[model samples]
Target: MTETTDYFDALATALLKGGMAEPAVSATLADLRGYLTETGTAAHEEFGPAGEFAARLAGGAPAGEPVAEAETWKWTADIYVDRKHLNAYGDQGWEVERIDRLGRFVSRRDPEAAMCWEYRREVTGIKDRTAMTEALAPEGWEVCGQWLYFQYFKRPKAASAGPAAVIETPPEAPGRRLFLSGGYRKQLVATLVAVVLCAALTAYAVGRGANVTAILIGAAVAAPIGGLLGWYAVKRDVLTGAKES
Candidate 1:
């Protein structure tokens, strides 16, 4: 048999021995075979030794009977602090399911069977998204969610640290949800001030019997302009912060 076949045989046998069901083992092999073909690299080169790779894969994916319910949590943080929180919660075995419409992270963990997870965020345009995913695929990162021009990827912590990735006991779920950074807080305050000022002006105009049509038209025009300015300001702040560090 060729080296590829030989490598897969060993991997499949290891996965089976590690308590992964047959169907899951087969799917994992198919995916890995496709990856090796696309990258034109040997399985051992791409994934290290077959035994170790199996340990990593099966460590995160231990098979067992389904539970009645799994613990769930949902929370969100600003771009500046999101990564920090993701890593922190992931260490405790929470797996993010998706980013909700409000950009909150919806996550869950099975008390019966749970493994440590890790996450990273990348910023890229739609055009570069394919390349970004392809580059990270070789390392076992899967796209978890995308929002606000940022892409989040996650992987089992076991993929890197082998058996060490096992979490014996997870901590209590965090209570506080919103984790806005100082920058976001400042922007919120500024936005509230602008809103108050606009409301005051509208009230004064109504008291003076100003044209309602004219006031409505003025607001319609200003809304987009204010939004554009806010977008520019946030981008500038991000860029400036990047350069400073």
Candidate 2:
């Protein structure tokens, strides 16, 4: 039928399949309804009523099955020093400990056995920074700015006899940061020059017997309007550059 109806139906289907906590799902839907009404989107405004109806149906439906165990896990690798051995190595030589699958640390001495206070482990497959941070907090882990040094684990090869090799995948490269293009810079400079010229013209006109106060006020007003035009020119140039790139 309508777009709003379609959206409502899709949300209902997702909730049914996902088995999300009912109260949270209901609250999220209500918030979405309010957002739609505020934004005055025709589809969302009309969809609100349909969503309410679907929400009622969902409330009575059986909860879906519990989520399956994660197929993958991620671990944070942090460097720590053994304070007990500090006197021998000046500052206790640094050691790299691997945060295990359960968010616990495992000593390199015993990779297969769980070591107390040596590592951290938690559920894995986190792609966002917030979730990753939360997972690592129980262990003395903190994000070092934007970079995260972590490891991921997957299902073990049940039949393999050899030790599991930790696979290291390179982090995704960031997009190139953009600066204002030369064309936009030129346009901005031109606009500033035009504004200055316009002010000088208005001053000269006032000096030549036009209403001085009115000329000055008019120049002040025209400067912003001229600048706005210049801003648009710069924006257009930027868009053209983006398209070319």
Listed in order, each prediction's TM-score against the native is 0.64, 0.26
* Stretches of candidate 2 exceeding 4 Å from the true structure: 1-180, 235-245
Q: Candidate 2, which ten residues in sequence have the lowest lDDT sum?
A: 86-95
Name every residue pair that clashes in candidate 2. 102-121, 102-122, 103-120, 103-121, 103-122, 104-119, 104-120, 104-121, 105-119, 105-120
Q: For each candidate in the order shown, give its overall lDDT on alpha carbons.
A: 0.77, 0.40
For model 1, which pairs clash? none
Task: Give one digit per residue, the lDDT tens place, for model 2 in 58-139.
Answer: 3323335433211111222221211222111111111222233233222121222211222222222335646876666664
- Model 1 root-mean-square deviation: 10.1
